[model samples]
Target chain A: MLKFNPRNYLKVTNGAVLLRAEIEKKMDEVSKKEFKNLFLIGSGGSIAIMYPFEYIWNSTSSIPAYAEIASEFMLQSHKQFDENSVVILSSLSGTTEETVEAAQYCKERGATTIGLVGEMDTPLANIVDYPIANYAENDYAADSINLQMYMIIFRLMHNNGEFAQYEQFVSELEKMPENLISVKEQTEEKAKEFADKYKDEDYHMLIGSGTAWGRTYAYSMCVLEEMQWIRTKSVHAAEFFHGTIELVERDTSIILLKGEDATRPLAERVERFAEKYTDKLTIFDTQDYTLDGISPEFRQYFPPLVLGSLLQRVSVHLENKRNHSLDKRRYYRTVAY
Target chain B: MLKFNPRNYLKVTNGAVLLRAEIEKKMDEVSKKEFKNLFLIGSGGSIAIMYPFEYIWNSTSSIPAYAEIASEFMLQSHKQFDENSVVILSSLSGTTEETVEAAQYCKERGATTIGLVGEMDTPLANIVDYPIANYAENDYAADSINLQMYMIIFRLMHNNGEFAQYEQFVSELEKMPENLISVKEQTEEKAKEFADKYKDEDYHMLIGSGTAWGRTYAYSMCVLEEMQWIRTKSVHAAEFFHGTIELVERDTSIILLKGEDATRPLAERVERFAEKYTDKLTIFDTQDYTLDGISPEFRQYFPPLVLGSLLQRVSVHLENKRNHSLDKRRYYRTVAY
Candidate 1:
């Protein structure tokens, strides 16, 4: 039997912080004129690494940025490159064929390639101009490293001319490493309560609207399906009214990520939806922060990048509710083509 | 009392032929330019319209082309545009916020904009330099116009320059409109079978992979949810093997869009999946095709586009199966939005 480590959240959160700091330290050395675009490439959990960074980028500098499934960037037509473009290639295993190929393609196209990896030495690290190494001593699939790398990039941009005005946001982000751990620890009782109450259900639905849309979409549909062997789907709250609410029954479970801004109207609607199915709705919201301050800019978006760590924690506890373990790699083959 | 006239597949086939001819005529004029990249933008069904064109472009030409959801495109940075680019904007309404915004953005960035629309009088038609209008005399939403416009575009590209090699393919497409009609007549039985067999089930899953992936993803996940008031989820067949198959049970309903080509292996897997449930599977294959020489270039990709019409047929039939007359509109609501 696996022993439950009480510090799971702290370890993961700290790892993310250190990872971010290390990446930013190195990025401080690179000249601003070197690259224009930052292509954050990954898939599955590896892709989640860039979400916070993407938010930071969109919030601070209008510097063009995009994230693609590594395979898509490599296989699709991506001629939008100059020597001045920076390609941040991330893969926890330092393998992920698509990310590897994307890194190679960027280098071939004369773009500056930056490697974010869990291992000190790998094909990805060897190919890129700069490699940020994370030993990934923890078995959390390098989420910490991914988070750290994104933070580093974000902080570097913020500290530099790109996002000088956004220094406060970076500082706020800096505070999250500790807050995330605290939140995860504090939320365990609530999560356990949620899992115990609704664990027997066969299906899970996650709903969100704006910015949180991608995260909820990724977590409920992709991550839960990939990690927990859960049959899950997500929808925009407004869209939920369009049709999906009919699928809600007393036995069905709905996880609503209300975040900050766009919560009230959707919350009221979901309250009615929950009443119809009585005792089937679960909401994850940042308690202390109102819609105004916590997510001042894209407040209507989901907040899991900061608070979603709690969901990640709750998901692990809810594994017993699933048909398999939390880390079931059934869908992924060891030998990637 | 409403009098029912049997749909003449032959006339429908002829209309498909005319639509293809018109789109092809336009493609002949457009393909002369040397473009390094092509981006097709649309939302919902309009994005579905680009399926066949992307298939033809991928198979016949060396140039890179792709169709992306307009909403996703809007979130990304677009400082990487100048000339030698082609952007095809598709939206029947001409006012889909995302598409309209993208059209304006693409135009501002110097990418040539071509509008494919149902209404010649709409803003999208007036905004673009070259607009191909497929006016739907009666229909409000994009039912016939979408298919007609795509067929025209594919045929024109097929006839242009080095594309002449696929002339036989174009001829087969010319015959597809008739095939679509015939298939619709045939699906009357299958749709009834689907409705009777699976209507009581609480969930529905639509599975496809590769080129067909997007269509199945959009239709079962997006359209069926919008139209049928059903709980449907779309899964890439490969991903199904990853973890989704565990959700299957004796009562579960699965719709497999088995397009021609590499889909067979996955289809066979799904067949076994259906058998495990003792016959709860409804599979749609290329028997829906009327034309034989429908170019096997991107065989894995093209079949789903062909199935677009087939899905519509099934949807209507499923309504009859449920003893519900299809409601075209909600009270006092305009379809224009």
Candidate 2:
């Protein structure tokens, strides 16, 4: 609760939900057009946000979806990408050099582009065919961008007749602002306890599987390393048994983000192994919290969202306890590289 | 050159090149059959080896290529995977649990599976439709497996009219055993110097781009973490600037795996930043080694293979200087989870 702003959180979340009409119109328009595949392109957190949707599309839709890093995507001639491809891009600042360049690249290739940005009338928003603008500070950008992505991605799938429960899912998504507040309230104590315990910890191995893998990666890189300056390794749970398991010891901190997806068993295997090997195992399972409006079947798709809100609490506590400003940076924007 | 066996290395590398005819026969047969997409599936180092090939396919061929983690691949219901798909799997041991299971899963789904294994009659080799077996010891497994993959993948692409230089490439492949010996001879001192300097270092950040990314990840996880019990963060060169750049101090060991590809600029960007930020930066560039029999046009495709041969030298030197056995593992197969 260090920087919690209930009014702003509601404004951002509800603002995304309110975009249901506009997002739907765009989805309908794109769905009506002929496209071969979906290219979800971005940089850093924006690219990480696309991974889950790519997974979902791969698992559920006949349409091929690729989550590509923007900088590399431009240079690497993806044989599957063409004029018939629909690309989705995001950047909170609307001026992430690579994302903007990627959008321009796609536009030049006659590909349809959609961009999500924090502010309008900027490079990224202006370059894309369809631009969705939502205002949120750095702390809540994930929540805002993720909510908008859920609408854009699922609506597209629904329009394609791949996801039938679109209306029902939106109805439930409307309750997330309130439900997420409860999730934060429930997780605050655990978050505080984890921060107090691990404030001085230098390294951690964060693991997750399936859709949860993206959050695990983004948190380790973007949040922990970038924001908190913590050294962390984010490995998929299924891949943990391969090489990373050798690095585990009794004191090695293992943070597991467990989700209720089909790949849950993979994470469970890591849980079993870590429970036996490391005494400092901490799990943030979405199943631990009760959402008032979310149904059991629908919960599988909500882990990333639930964990996004929950991890924000952990980040705030870490910032408060470690006496490190979350916004402080040594080189990100301070000096010329 | 510690533990370097020229005869065995030649035996393994040439043995794989000799499989060119059999590999082509199998690829021709598979190409005659209709397939929609290509799935290169494995776990850890096995999976890491597929990334560069996936990049190759995306850059050069008209097929949609996905390199997936085997354990999670089996759990996630991938809509793009079906009877009409072709799957390429590899396991140096031929008994990697998740890979064998994935082959079985693919076989049950009626997909065409081609497996590359170290030995014949193993679970993975036995389960796939086409099993290409080559003899290789633990140290030379990457060399053997990579050589075989080049044959199988390029042959398939050639059969599909995607690659016109298959025969020319094969002629160049025949000289790799001798050429790689030279690569090792040239890298010996540099690798030894790296080992001598970093023997006591606890952590490093490995960066790479394009075809070198897979080797970067594998060297960090499989060699350093699993084998030497050292800690490392392997990040793509493009992603390095996004988050990991902040962790750079004057003494941070930055291992840059520079390759000749379009994404070379991305790695060069990291090189520039690391040069400015960290004094302990070590770059292993493929351009430094003159491969005698390889043509300039074919150099881009050889980085992963070149890096594989070069990194083995680094691994051997580290094993000696650090007084740590490269075969040592705390939990990989030492005990049950």
Best by TM-score: 2
lDDT of 2 at A156: 88
Clashes of 1: 12
**TM, every model:** 0.73, 0.99
True contacts kept of each: 0.11, 0.81
Best model per lDDT: 2
lDDT of each: 0.60, 0.90
Candidate 2: tens digits of C-alpha lDDT, residues A20-94: 899999889999886899999987788888888898888998999999998899999798999999999988889
Q: Backbone collision count in every prediction?
A: 12, 0
lDDT (Cα, tens digit) per residue for candidate 1, span B88-147: 886666776667887887888777778876667788888776676654432223435445
Task: Tell me the TM-score of candidate 2's A chain.
Answer: 0.98
Candidate 1's error at A29, in angstroms?
8.3
